[model samples]
Target chain A: MDENNLIKMELTVNGEAVSMIVKGGRRLLDFLRDDLHLTGTKEGCGEGECGSCTVHLDGQSVLACLTPMERAIGCSVLTIEGVGSPTNLHPVQAALLDEGGVQCGMCTPGMVMSALDLLERNPDPTIEEIIEGISGNLCRCTGYKKIIYGIQQAAQELQAASPAGTVKESVE
Target chain B: MLYRKYEVAQTLPEALSLLSSHNGAVVRPVAGGTDLILQLHERILSADVLVDISRVPELRGIRLENGQLVIGAATTYTEISRSDLVLKNAFVLAEASKKIGAVQIQNMATLGGNIGNASPAADAIPGLYALQADVVVCGPNAERRIPITEFHQGYRKIDLNPGELIKEIRFAIPAEGTGTAFYKYALRKSQAISVVDAAVCVQLSDGVIKHATVALGAVAPTIIRSPAAESVLIGEPPSEDLFDRAAEAACQDARPIDDIRGSAAFRKYLVGVCTSHAVRSACERAA
Candidate 1:
């Protein structure tokens, strides 16, 4: 936009200020993986055919492969790396670990990203909604039954934990 | 081969200026860049300069002005599906918009980009045709409005010029006696492209057909209206016989090809089936 101005973008990623010099064509997935060293958002298909590169763009789930870095300049981004660790666990991470949801773990982050969006929209979703939520994400392993099972477990855990106070207001 | 440098245009004028300067140099306006990028990856299409226009705020939102529902060219399918205005006033548009690709695709794929792509199986073409939408196109020097029916010239060609870009799509809201509906026949419910889709908007006068616009897609090189079928509904009483005749006539306008998605005969059959459903849906809404 500002050819001369050379946009100096500043954003918060995983609760940290992330500043980077991004071109118009640089997709957010590339910037995160290359510059920020956050390889959790795996790139399955760079053209958005697969949701393996899903990430939280301003708290909404989107395919990072299609999202331009310029748009994420001022937005909040959260990848799988930000969600939880092997030691400390988010409910989804915990459920995914507890269940055998991690087949190859290639599409896990994207599935989690999409499931997070689903939970935000429909907290107590049916099996169909859960299936619909992760349909965009392509998982080569687990036959998707385990992933669905993992989501159900996570929903139960999240519901019991009572995130009404933790869950932010809907962006709708 | 898919790799290329990108230039983001924050303003409409700047984007247009690039278009004017580039003469068939493989420059394209990127909205969601979903389909375009995939086509490039598969070596289906090629572009040198991807003029990023996603940041242009001018090409977004839906509004009602002068009895017409005006939608910005860069508005996403997700935005269209979620808009209460589209759900109430332009339900057919919303219906088709929701069925496009999946959630990730819908969240980024723009309505104008889909229309401009000029593909044979575009989900929104029939809906826009049923609405009688006017595509407002802007070129270097001036702008003009072209009806959606006449926008496509061939299978993958459009009426757009070298320096032109679609600014907005506008159509008059349906009248009090009119009801609109759109139906898509895809392999999968949400993600798959349409095998055959139909949009029917009917205007009835006390159970008599006052006017009818029946549009069908994916059954021909481009989306088309069955003049033969539309004529039969001019003054006839809405009934099963009318629907049968309309569907039959609608099938006559189709010339589908046997592709990986479906066979020519199957698509033809779907034209009739979808037309019947579309007519029934609109009739129910009108009733």
Candidate 2:
């Protein structure tokens, strides 16, 4: 490939502005994983059938595999790596751990990302909303019952932590 | 690489110019690349250049002008599904937009992409067809408006000229005493392609059906309007028996083929069932 074909993109990833020259046709999934080493966003289905590569572009959950790298030129990208660290987990992540939402763990990042976005929009989503919220993220293991439970638990945890009915500052 | 070059056009004219310049190249305009990227990934389609029009301000809004809803072609499904104007004027379209895929896909998929793809199973096309929408296409030299009912030419094919781009989708607001409904029978409740989908718009006057439009998807080469089914409800009063007969008529109009998602027989059965449900619900909403 000619180097001139590569476009220069400056985007904010995980709250940090980063610059890179990339092939315009590169999928955001490949750019994140291979270039930025954000492997937390897994790739289960390259065709966008599976939402394992789900990430937040401009605060909305989107499949990275189906998004061209050029689309992120001036956008903000939030992946699972930015959600919470291993030591400091987000409420949704902690709830998943407490509720045993993880079995194979490949879909956990995407599920957590989807759940976070859902909670951001609807803080106290019902069980049905939780099911619909995470419907895009599929998990072959855990049967999804525990994932629903995890989201429910997260909602309660978030509500209790903020008496004013606002999400906790830690989530930000 | 799937595309050797990618150009982001700041304006509609710039995009048209790029298309004209790359007339010989396999170039595709991409707004929300949800479907196009998947097609590229599956190797069903290839492009030498991808002209990114997703950021064109002129092609990304939803507004009501002169009592007609003008939806910018690049408006995402997320925007349509949540638009109050769409909810008040064309709720069935909003409902169909919500059912296209999950939140991720909805956030990235545009109505223009859905219509441009011209997939028979496209969820929004049936509702658009029922709404009597018009598609506005602009090219380098000419602009044309094609009715949504006549937009699709065949399986995965649309009546779009080369170097042309969809500008907006326009449709009149449903008048008082009119109700619209959309129903989809997919393998899953969400994030699944429709096995069969139906959209119905019915206008009632003096307890009689004054006007009716019934459209079916995923059961034919293109989203089809069932004139026979619509004729059944035109002069008749709303009744379960009438809805059933209209559904049977809709089934006769459908031309489904066996596919991986479902068999032709099963799809045919769904056509009747969904059509009846859609008509009944639409009538109830109208009353």
Candidate 3:
């Protein structure tokens, strides 16, 4: 590694403050997977076409593959690992499990991230809106019907969980 | 990892200084990183130093200044699409912003990046041409404003000097009797590059077209104004027949080439279709 080419970045990932020296041009996806050892975020297409690299940056969904580490400085990033665990899954994750949304599992994390962002912006989205919300994510398995159902179920669960009717932040 | 150094500029002067003082090293200003990062990763473009201007305070936000919509170059597409001022003042731009790629791309892509990428098929550019937008570019010496038409030289080419960076984009707010609309023909409703796109702004006085502009994308080397179509509608009354004639004239101005996304003949045909539809919609809104 060339020390002169290294950049020091400070950012909040999954609610933890991280300060480290990384390659100036290192992508956020590489930082998450290799440096932080958070492998939940998947990279389907290195280009921006596939949404497999979706993650939350400052509460908005963005493609990690296209986002450089320098861009993440002083920003808050949320990953799939931060959203939930096996013991207690996020409502979207649990709903997908119950609704049979996961098949190949490659698109699940990005699907969940985009879904959460959709619901955050629009608490009650129609079927067409759900499709538009996840339009960036390409899922070859399950034909998307089951995934749509899972998102609907997740919206219902989320609405029920928050009786106050406030926008639910995806991560605490 | 194509760049050897990344430096975030907190202000516009710092960005300009960094860009100019690179000492012959290839330097590029990165905002949004949706396009430049991809090109860098694919080895299509390389830079010795990258200046991050995305966070520069002077290069973010959208505001109304002296009856013109001033949008900082770093403002994201998502911000433009959702802005109340943009929706009310320049709805065609907002509409164009909404249809670029999808939600994720919208969140990261910026209008300046669209211009900087200089893609003939850029979805947001046709609207700028129709609206007669201007780009403000800042350099180490001074800032200059260039009209949208002159800003783009050719496919993947813009009029930016080596030490200059785009500062903001601004356009006069359309009058109350004016209407504008944008139409894009892509393979899909989302995430597909445009095969052909058109944007029209019509000003009507007592139900007669007083002024009009027609712009098309992906059918030429750069987003082009259809003077033939504009002349056809400038003094005519709004009607389906007249719009069709104007569209036919617009078709004559297209210089499209056969590509994977579309063919020259099809693109020329769609120019008429898109222009006619966009003109009709704009006239309807004007009425």
Chain A only: TM-score of every candidate?
Answer: 0.88, 0.92, 0.92
* Candidate structures ordered by TM-score, highest first: 2, 3, 1
Model 2 ranges off by over 4 Å: A1-4, A163-172
DockQ of 1: 0.36
Off by over 4 Å in 3: A1-4, A165-172
Candidate 3 collision pairs: none
lDDT of each: 0.82, 0.91, 0.91
Give candidate 2's error at residue A76 in angstroms: 0.7
Scored by Cα lDDT, where does model 3 land?
A: 0.91
Q: What's model 1's lDDT at A126?
A: 83
Q: Interface Cα RMSD for candidate 2?
A: 1.8
Better of 1 and 3 by DockQ: 3
Q: Report each candidate's C-alpha RMSD, comma-separated, in the order given.
A: 3.5, 2.6, 2.7
| Per-residue lDDT of candidate 1, residues B72-140 (tens digit) | 889988899989988888788888887787778888889899889988789888989888898999987
DockQ of each: 0.36, 0.67, 0.67
Candidate 3 on A10-59: residue-level lDDT in tens?
99999999999866678999999988899999999889987999999999
